[model samples]
Target: MSTCPTCSKPATADFAPFCSERCRHIDLNRWFTGAYAVPAVELDDVDFEEAESATTPPKSDDFNA
Candidate 1:
């Protein structure tokens, strides 16, 4: 049997990943209250042009040799 994601108890078919309605509600409440969050990178810390430049090699100085 699959374990509950919120409480680690045996999961119920009704809730699939959760053991019961209570655990499912608890998980939903966390999302509503911002207890769970997705991480984001600040744009200020990233330089798109600089990142592009790093992936590209500098132009060769000599056409041959």
Candidate 2:
């Protein structure tokens, strides 16, 4: 059996990873308050422009609908 992430107690069927609703709420609060975050590399303007251009379709001069 897995232990609750918030309280370290035995996990219950009602909350597979948390012992109780309070613990579950505590985990959720952490997420809402930015306690957990996904790491990302910052891109500069040049990198952003290159990525954007690579994905953008080229403009066409044809008049066909």
Candidate 3:
């Protein structure tokens, strides 16, 4: 028998790929809540911090340049 992807239990006929309805629901919840997110690969040339800073308004520097 194949193991369940979520809980590592022997898959049941009722659940087929999943061991139980609970495991199925857990997997579904993960998808719904974005818990099972795929990692995004950032390019070496991409400056994420700079991009964010540009979008935000600059704070007043009254003391010095």
Candidate 4:
């Protein structure tokens, strides 16, 4: 018998490749909720922080003005 990708249990005929409906649903939920995420690395610490700060824009200074 083949193993279930989600729970690693033995696959069942009823669930086909998956061990059970629960495992299948869990896998689906993971995809839907973005639980299966890929990690991204900061190529350069200084440039990455600068890019993040620039994209956030600056707070208004109207009160002082």
Candidate 5:
């Protein structure tokens, strides 16, 4: 049997990595309360404009819409 991630008890097949439904709820509560998060770097407007300019095609005066 696999060890439970929350309480280190022997894992049940229903919960897989966690020991019981209670442990699963506890883990969920942690996430809800901001205990877990993916790291990110905020981008600036200059970065967005630069990327947009590089990828976007130039507007043509001759082509009629």
Candidate 6:
């Protein structure tokens, strides 16, 4: 019922979203070659400081104890 994402043909049972092995491979090649990218949100300065503090070790006045 659904169309193949690569060729726009009717999708097959084996490949589901893709029409055939070739089409599937084409889509895979795009991912392997960095053709597709995942989007990320930019972190603010406040968020960066909070993350840094979480990983930093605590200081103690009595280091010898």
Clashes (candidate 6): 0
Per-model lDDT = 0.88, 0.92, 0.88, 0.88, 0.89, 0.94
lDDT score for candidate 3 against the true structure: 0.88
Residue 43 alpha-carbon offset, candidate 1, angstroms? 0.2
Off by over 4 Å in 6: 51-65
Models 1 onward score TM values of: 0.65, 0.76, 0.54, 0.51, 0.65, 0.68
> In candidate 2, which residue ranges exceed 4 Å CA deviation?
57-65
Q: What's model 1's overall lDDT?
A: 0.88
Cand. 4 TM to true fold: 0.51
Better model by lDDT: candidate 4 vs candidate 6: 6
User: Which residue pairs does candidate 2 place in steric collision?
Assistant: none
In the order shown, the candidates' Cα RMSDs to the true structure are 5.9, 3.0, 9.8, 8.1, 4.2, 4.9
Summarize candidate 5's per-residue lDDT along 1-65 as a digit string, tens digits.
78988899999998988989999999999999999898987779999889888998867964765
Task: At residue 13, give the lDDT of candidate 5.
Answer: 92
Give per-residue CA lDDT, model 4, range 1-65, as digits (tens).
Answer: 89999978899999978999999999989989999988987569888888898898566885567
Clashes of each: 0, 0, 0, 0, 0, 0
* Model 4, backbone clash pairs (residues 3+ apart or across chains), number: 0
Model 4 Cα RMSD, 1 decimal: 8.1
lDDT (C-alpha) at residue 51 in model 2:
92
* Residue 19, model 1, lDDT: 96
Residue 2 in candidate 1 has what lDDT?
89
Q: Specify the poorest-scoring 10-residue window by lDDT in model 3.
A: 43-52
* Candidate 4 CA-lDDT value: 0.88
Worst 10 residues of 4 by lDDT: 56-65
**Tens-digit lDDT track for model 1 on 1-65?**
88999999999998988999999999999999999999976555358677777898767864455
Candidate 3 ranges beyond 4 A from true positions: 38-65
Candidate 5 — what's its lDDT?
0.89
